[model samples]
Target: MKRLYRALLWLFPPGYRLAFGDEMTAVFEALARDRRRRGKAVYLEFLLTESITLIAGAVLEWIEKAAGREYPADVAAARRAETDVSVPAEIIEARQRVTTLVSLMTDAISRYDYKRARFYSLAEERERRRLRALETGQA
Candidate 1:
């Protein structure tokens, strides 16, 4: 059951899984065990419900990711900073670009496209370095 649960987790977006997979798995395991204590019927019901919900959640998350509706931690912080009138638009735009590159890398990895993933990884790193250099007045 745990193995099946782990396999089903692959349906989730890579970033979402990276952020919450272990914790979600742990919680699922605990709930499964507790439900089993009631009866086979109860346990089966719990498993079915959980599995369906997980699949639905994964679909929604993928939609959000594809639509650019989700943001990474750093990007979200940068977006929040945009609310400040003093923050430069260029910085916010750069942060958003980095976030997009990261999302592309994760998507590539999820699809088992290592070459594309490597390219995006390098691109993201270069962008981050450029941002840092700009901050330090070296670029």
Candidate 2:
């Protein structure tokens, strides 16, 4: 029941789970309870939907991991493909940033706590400023 749902959640990307994991589980539990009141089939429908989302959410991580993997290049064609077909490093960095935000937002969204993201963002900005001030010896 709930255990199975919890286990299925592990299929989601790590970034996603880092942010929204527990909140989503709580949500699923609530939904499951509601569905149980309705019928087991209704609960099953919810479970299926969750499984699909978990798999889909994992795709972003998989893509990034695949892109980062170093492939064997014994074949000349492999080397050419590696050199010729690729995303720019900037795009890869941007993707990494987006993954971070996605994880943060997911956590905030699941917690029903928008302020966590906002506060963290502001804190980061403040810390950057403070570091700059420190570097300049300006307190």
Candidate 3:
């Protein structure tokens, strides 16, 4: 099942996959683990539902790409927020830094690299504080 899921993830655009493939794989594994505890029937149902969703999502992503859209809609929303004219550049940079840190932390956690994850967690906290300060005009 996991193999199939990973294969399906390859259907996404290369850049999108590079950014989100590991995270999505981690989430799928976690969900599968939890559902397995609920019994075979529930787990099988989850697999069917998730597989359908994955295929549909990949198709939509491809369509969006073909239409000249860059990034998923959710990611475009985040980029829009980041680019708000009212927001200071420093704040935007800090927010982006924090986001990157969080992604690194999650990737580390997914790989069971606790030490690396903890390092990223601490860095993310610092960036979060910097972002807050920038937002409040204190930095």
Task: Give the winner by TM-score.
Answer: 1
Q: What Cα-based lDDT does every candidate model obtain?
A: 0.76, 0.56, 0.76
Could you give the C-alpha RMSD of every candidate to the true structure, in order shown? 10.4, 15.7, 12.1
> Which is better, 2 or 3, measured by TM-score?
3
By TM-score, rank the candidates, best first.
1, 3, 2
Stretches off by above 4 angstroms in model 2 are: 64-139
Q: Candidate 1 on 1-139: residue-level lDDT in tens?
A: 9888976875665556656778889999999989999999999999999899989997688668766776585245444555656756666576567767877877897799999999998998788777656656687
For residues 1-139, what per-residue lDDT tens digits would candidate 3 score against the true structure? 7888987875564445656788899999999999999999999999999989988987676556545576565566666666689877877787667657766766687689999989998997787777667776887
- TM-score of model 3 vs. true structure: 0.50
Q: What global local distance difference test value does model 1 have?
A: 0.76
* Candidate 2 residue-wise lDDT, 1-139, digit = tens: 6777666654444344545667878988888788878887887787788778767766554454334532232133323423543644443343344445545655665577978868655654455455445534575
Clash pairs (backbone) in predicted model 1? none
Give TM-scores for every candidate, taking all chains together and pairing residue i with residue i: 0.52, 0.40, 0.50
